[model samples]
Target: MIEERNPTNTWIVDDDSIYVYGLKKLISIKGINTNLSHFINGQEGINALKKANENQQLPDIILLDINMPVMDGWEFMNEFAKLKPQLGKNITVYIVTPSLDLNDIHRAKSIPEVAEYIFKPVKISQLTEIFSQTQYQTNERIRQYGT
Candidate 1:
């Protein structure tokens, strides 16, 4: 078993059990110590994010799965946008999907909050890349957007 951390987060939104297992496995294998949180759908993720926002501690990262049962990643982003300046600098979202569809990739590329569109069966390398990208991007955003 992996040791859980406090402050609620590096998060994931996915309905599939196997993917969740694999993701958790990756996090553990990579020695990621952040609080690992998950939600079955985007709505739940949004609710948690909202609560976190109100509490002044949104997640460090959000791994969003595209094809979910209710309220998909796009919807989550839309909902998040309406939250009245709740999310701070560290809250970044990444689209994690098994699909190789070009349209999906294109769409992911278009979204600003979406830091990157990562392929599923997500590897250690991808995780490392994501970490680097997110760190750089977040810092740039904080600089440009101010906090």
Candidate 2:
């Protein structure tokens, strides 16, 4: 019997529509099973996260961009930190940006919630590794928590 895998709930919080479109296409081409939600900026992402938290339907992974209009990634991280303790499940956040600033990289590294910092124009290999890790972690969590 083949074991069925659940789709990963994923979010892309970014202002660039073109980038989002490309990323979605890449994900589809890779045959990754993901239920993706897109937010134009950090504020929208935060609001959606709040609603998701209330409904206990939080995303499993977040690909966040650094620069946005309403709220930047740093600001969003601040808000996320405050709201995290109330969340029912763990969410892995990746900093996906074009910025090559060392400060930004260091900042992301400093944050405990950030899993990794990825450069823009994300590669297929990186996506594969990330989803594979996500699946492994999800399976491990299920084995341990039965949830």
Best candidate per lDDT, number? 2
Candidate with top TM-score is 2
Task: Write candidate 2's Cα lDDT for 50-105 as tens digits.
Answer: 99998988999999999999899999999999999999889999999999999999
List TM-score per model, in order.
Answer: 0.79, 0.95
Instruction: Give the clashing residue pairs of candidate 1, or none.
Output: none
**Across residues 73-136, which tens digit of lDDT does each residue of candidate 1 receive?**
8888788667637565357788999989999999889877787788888878888776656556
Model 1 — which ten-residue stretch has the worst lDDT? 1-10
- Candidate lDDT scores, in order, read 0.77, 0.93
Q: Which segments of model 1 are wrong by more than 4 Å?
A: 1-8, 132-147
